[model samples]
Target: MKLREALALAIGGDLAHLAEVARQLSSLGVRVEPGGDVVWGPTRLLGKGNNGVVVFCRSRHGDIYACKIRRGDAQRPHLLDEARYLQIANGVGVGPRLYAYTRDVLVMEYVEGTPVADWWRAAGAEERARFVADLLRQARALDLAGISHGELSRPGKHVLVARGGRAVILDFESARPGAQNVTQAANLLRALGLTPPLEALRRYAERRDDLAFNELLSSLLGQLKR
Candidate 1:
């Protein structure tokens, strides 16, 4: 289907509103087929979630992108907010790169990989450890940057293990600036069934022992590397 038509169908209601949206999209250099056929550039539905529906779309240059579109009734702040957070993540070498976005649509580098749970099941011990390290690194980056990923506690569909052993974190609508954060590390420990670190961190906090905490984290990383 034409891009505009597919968008219209996905977000139904008034034709005029859809036209305006199409116009805005066109201004952003987006091209849509008028023909009701989606064959020119194939699209695959990536997912449909509370944030929006994600589809893998190919550009004329044959580059694939993950396009996230806002549902008609999706609440305030829109895709723009999500786009902003994604930009932040991009700066720190986390998440997919943001290609472009308007008020209701987001286009970004398409990350192809297996979901975390599936990957975990198939990964060897070394691979699992490395993946865990990467996950913690990313979480630490976010926390240090003052960005809180509210859903990391229940990660769910948010993390992907890309080809070549890369870990990509997706979805940022629930992210917000915060003073201190523990969602990422806590959730990761929960997944790994490691509870001692949480308590160790608490003890370090009480004693204000930065070196001890660093040593502890280093010890954990070393074990994972081995």
Candidate 2:
């Protein structure tokens, strides 16, 4: 089936409000083409989530972008959150670029990459350790900026493993300010069942000269043991 047809089927044919979504995208200058279709030229669907679909599209000017559309009530909030997070994470190197957003959709620079889950399963121990370190850096940056990715524990939703040792985060629908970075990291590690370098992770967060975060991780991991 065609992509549009497939999208319609995925979203449910009889669902209301989709027409409004399409119209909103047009008003936001998304270049709606003939046949009620948005021309994201040379784009493909990367993945679909429970409430939304993610597509990679090339703009008419030859720029690649990712478009995410959320369904029903999740549309507006997620769109706003993604836009804000992209703004915050722009120079942090842990997120995508925010281009445009409507009530139910978001457009950003496309990240060509793999999910961390698959990458972690296939990577060597060294690469895995590096990935963990990078993830910790990202968490620290978010913490410093006072942002928390609320759904970081959701399997494929948390981290996107890109080419060239680059990692990007996705799904900020629940991101909020004032979250505890250490607790978030612990939760993520526990959910993934991986023993992170907690001492190093803590030192990175605290910016200490000779602090031992591994001991902290050990302590935390031990707590989980009891």
Choose the strongest candidate by lDDT: 1
Taken over the whole model, the C-alpha lDDT of each candidate is 0.65, 0.61
Give the Cα error of residue 142 in candidate 2, in Å.
Answer: 0.4
TM-score of 2: 0.71
Candidate 1 lDDT over residue span 54-98, tens digit each: 766556666667777676656654678788888887887778899
Model 2: pairs clashing at backbone N, Cα or C within 3 Å: 198-213, 199-213, 199-214
TM-score of each: 0.78, 0.71
For candidate 2, lDDT tens digit of each residue in 27-120? Answer: 6555322121233333335655666666654556656566777755443444676667767866566577787787577777777677776776
